[model samples]
Target: MVRLDRITTRGGDAGETSLGEGSRVRKDTARIEAIGAVDEANAALGLLRAQIAAAGADAEADAMLARIQNDLFDLGADLCVPGAEATDARTGRTRLRVSDAQSARLEAEIAAMNAALPPLASFVLPGGSLAAAQAHVARAVVRRAERRAVRLAAEETVNPAVIRYLNRLSDHLFVLARRLNRNGAGEALWVPGGARQG
Candidate 1:
């Protein structure tokens, strides 16, 4: 686990930050952008966790979110180092990287959770219960993170697992939202023309 010795390092006060390998880059780089998006998504998950806990929702979902939050930290560390070969300057250890196993686990859990939900006849409008609403928010954030990761991959040698995990995480959040909505009991379905004036 990485320890924070100081909270106010002012490291990025010059618009540059250090990577996992001790290399410095502009804070606005694609890698940093991707990491920022992932961090935001993780924060959204935290909000969802709090909402679910307050509502006394399912314990499994809470545990899942906690695990995903930890996974997001790993992902942030992975994005800190570019390419497939980078040894940390301080620890002299290979930088962290997302793996296929993480994505695979998300897929499996998504399948299991989705199995209990009803068929969706229309688009979801990001509402049902408070917990579900927050889950939807988290899902949207994860989608943004996935897009940023994809853009980074196009420019550099990104691990396929990173993109894969983001993709699966969004799907998992979607299914989790549905599941938390009491298995689609009263979801706010979208109607394409229902809002138009007749």
Candidate 2:
């Protein structure tokens, strides 16, 4: 439904960008920062998906990542329009916002993926198969995005569901990484104080 005829609008050349409501704000504003973080997380997901496809990993995980990417777009849209609930005055149409159901779906996926994985005896080291490593990277980015969203929420009204979704997403990515690591077969567990030279 969105059309982009011109890629270079030269709109942000002045260090200000337009929000969904047509108001311009500095690029460094908290709202913009949150949106940028979400965008970065989405890009990370894309990279993870590429690694998954390259390794011929689980198709189900790739499918989940695809859905999460779309959800990130929805989250970005929700942030662009300020307010916990926003509606267009002329058309009386409510703006696109993140719903609790989306977050619930992520929780369900996380639970399902984690059900078969072995219990963790130690903390994960964030390296395993290429796809699993990529998943860890994506998880880190999502955590950063969640922090940015929380920062924005402190300064202004934000939909609680947006923050909830980001929180659950990071957890989902963590569990997915473990799942991609051959259900703990390829995972590297931390060895406390093992690196110390006696």
Candidate 3:
């Protein structure tokens, strides 16, 4: 329901961006870094989703990607909040926070997916079908985002759910990659030297 055209105020041309609290800071600040990493993960997912669509696969993956995109927006809102709420008096939008239930949902999904995948015996190189390989790339980015959020949490008040979500998301991506690789035409490759260990 938000209008798009009138929102960009051109106030950030000087290397500063506005937070939810109306205060401006350098674009490279910890808050921005966390948000940026999330955005990157979202974009990567989008790319993989598009490839899936092109392949005429089932709609499940696309549907999930759409949901994840929405969650990323929520995460950005949570990150942009100055403290716990917005500063603008006209709009009563509050700061973003992740709930325990959301984190639990991700954990549940990871557990279900990991249950189906075989145990890893050694470090594996990341590549597979185009979509699956892209998923792996997104997984790596999600891990980086998790680390960045952890650092941010150390310095400021970040929602713990964000960290939990990132951790689970990386695991989700790994499973998705393997599943996609199992699809027709996918050629999943493992590290040539990898051997299962008892």
Candidate 4:
């Protein structure tokens, strides 16, 4: 088992940090922002998972969220490593690249979830259950992260998979918010005096 306390070493106090592959870089590096964004998104998802678990939702959703948490960790690793190549501790080989297959999977998940949701006629107000609201917040943060990654791409070689991942993840979170609102018995709030169906 991994000890939680061993993760932080205060190595970033001087505005310098180490990547997952053991290369030291500045804290404000594009790679670092990309990784940090994934971390923030993962934490937001954790909050949603905890809310769902506490509300006694089905085990399947909770299980999915757990898998997402792990995937985000891998994503962070991918972003942190330079040139998308890192020596794998377990395999003793350079393991990198996020893979087109992973991006496809996220797309598939988003499609599946959106299929069950009602068609949207108006802009959504991002609030309902605590979980739904937080999911929306996560979605927005992921968009910001995507922008940062794009900026980095302009100056460096970034894995295209990272871009695709963020795009799909935002879609996933949007659908997730709808799902949580439905499942948690929270009503979707329309804006006051908003236009109705034509």
CA lDDT of every candidate: 0.90, 0.95, 0.76, 0.78
Model 4 local distance difference test score? 0.78
Instruction: Write candidate 2's Cα lDDT for 1-198 as tens digits.
Output: 899999999999999999998999999999999999999999999999999898886999999999999999999999999987767776788899999999999999999999999999899999999889988999999999999999999999999999999999999999999999999899998988978957
Q: Which residue pairs in candidate 2 have backbone atoms (N, alpha carbon, C) closer than 3 angstroms, thus clashing?
A: none
Candidate 3 clashing pairs, residues 3+ apart or interchain: none
Q: Model 2 off-target regions past 4 Å?
A: 89-91
Task: Tell me the deviation in Å of residue 20 in model 3.
Answer: 0.9
Residue 27, model 4, lDDT: 86
The candidate that achieves the highest TM-score relative to the unseen native structure: 2
Ranking by TM-score: 2, 1, 4, 3
- RMSD, each candidate, Å? 1.9, 1.1, 4.1, 3.9
TM-score of each: 0.94, 0.97, 0.83, 0.83
Of the pair 1 and 2, which is ahead by lDDT? 2
Q: How big is the positional error of residue 60 in model 4, measured in Å on the Cα after superposition?
A: 2.5
Cα miss at 50, model 4 (Å)?
Answer: 0.5
Clash totals for all candidate models: 0, 0, 0, 0
